[model samples]
Target chain A: MSFKKVVVFPAKLENLAAIDALIKSTAELAGLDARSIYAIRVATEEACSNIIRHAYQGIEDGTIECGCYSNMDSFTLVFRDSGHVFDLTGVPSPDLDSCLEDRKAGGLGVYFIKQLMDEVSFEHIPGTGNVLTLVKYLTPDSEKSST
Target chain B: MEYIVEKLKHCDLLSISGRIDSQSAPELSEALDKIMESGQHKIVLDMSEIEFISSAGLRILINAQKKCKQQLVAGELVLAAVPERVHEALDMAGFLPLFTIEDELTHAVGNI
Candidate 1:
């Protein structure tokens, strides 16, 4: 079976709770285990936070639409925002192996979103908006172990 | 998120609960900054009650750990009683090697 839940909120840090709740309930309904659910939650949070912090920076009244789509095969999240052109692909990876003082922290959020999700795609439409989609595949073994 | 800071004999203990996402990460950073500003570098972070931590939280932890290690006093930050889910998040971020982790708060405070 498949289902979807979506929420639209102003692209502000304060509204992250509502965004987190949306993803949590969707992941629970998909019968994900504690770890997978946490992964999805963190990935989606990172996506939304990036949108708010970077995409909507200096823009007024910007909004983000998050959709949680789940099925027997996979769980997917789609984020849409009408802010500036912020390409996550262009962001460089953080130097994880570097010493603490030499390491940088700026790109971890995008890196985490890519690391946690199974498949991710970003598309931008001219004068429309940017759509970022994250997917996590579901396995029967995973579903059974959670129960 | 909520935090309680306790000044122990060898190190300061900061107990944090609730989600540490982008919004609340600033608060965590502030709390750690205050502890370091007081010339105390050794810290034991009690994360037994933390339900979730995002990359934002991880950034704060790494930055604080760096400061604790590189500061003139040269102290370390120890994570204590980390929940399983939170531990996995740290592991996924490749952060497990950055700090010493203990299974109990008493052990973290005692060792640090």
Candidate 2:
């Protein structure tokens, strides 16, 4: 199947549902199984949520663009934002061994994106914007099971 | 996200549905705040109808549970009927062990 779709919208938390819905349909139509589709949708949602929270700082009026592309073997989702560039590399995954009383809870957004996707790349363009691409490899077991 | 709040046997039961992200996290927090302010500590979040969750949602749960623990009396937050998809997110976030989760609402309420 040949699938290349691009969606550009305001970078806001309210638009998260729309973004997630799009990712769900796109991944499902690409012949992915339920687990694969959920993973991709979650990663995409986390990326967009990061953009809306950190990049726009919940400003209510920034811009976010996403492209859903797929080939025979894998599916790729790219997110671009233009408010403030966020460096995901510097972000540390929350320590899981900490005590419940001492545990912190808000820093797991980016970590979810990294853990769920097979390949994740973040780039900061000199004069353009930030682009985060999350890839999901298609499996033969899921190819026969499409939801 | 939509929440259905009901005062059950031993705790305040909140049945949540729809997507819980940055936008809806505040709503959940607000609901919990109201319950907490009313001197109710024990709570159960039923995610049977919940389809999605993010860090924002998880933060609310953590905060709520933490505040409950700080109480001088009985205070607890449990989760019930969590879907597999929601479980995946919680597992990836390293939050599966943070709270008492049950396969059935009765068990969660009893456990709490």
Best candidate (score: DockQ): 1
Clashing residue pairs, backbone N/CA/C < 3 A, model 1 = none
- The residue-by-residue lDDT of candidate 1 on B39-88, one tens digit each, is 99999999999988998999999999998999776899999999988887
Candidate 1 residue spans exceeding 4 A from truth: A141-147
Candidate 1 residue-wise lDDT, A81-106, digit = tens = 99998889678788778767777777
Winning candidate number (TM-score): 1
Interface RMSD of 2: 1.3
Query: Which residue segments of model 2 deviate by more than 4 Å?
Result: A58-60, A140-147
- What does candidate 1 score on TM? 0.94
Model 2 error, position A30 (Å): 1.1
Q: Candidate 2, TM-score vs. the true structure?
A: 0.93
Standalone chain B TM-score for every prediction = 0.98, 0.94
Candidate 1 chain A lowest-lDDT run of ten: A138-147
Looking at model 2, the pairs that clash are none
Count of backbone collisions within predicted model 2: 0
Interface RMSD values for the candidates, listed in order? Answer: 1.1, 1.3
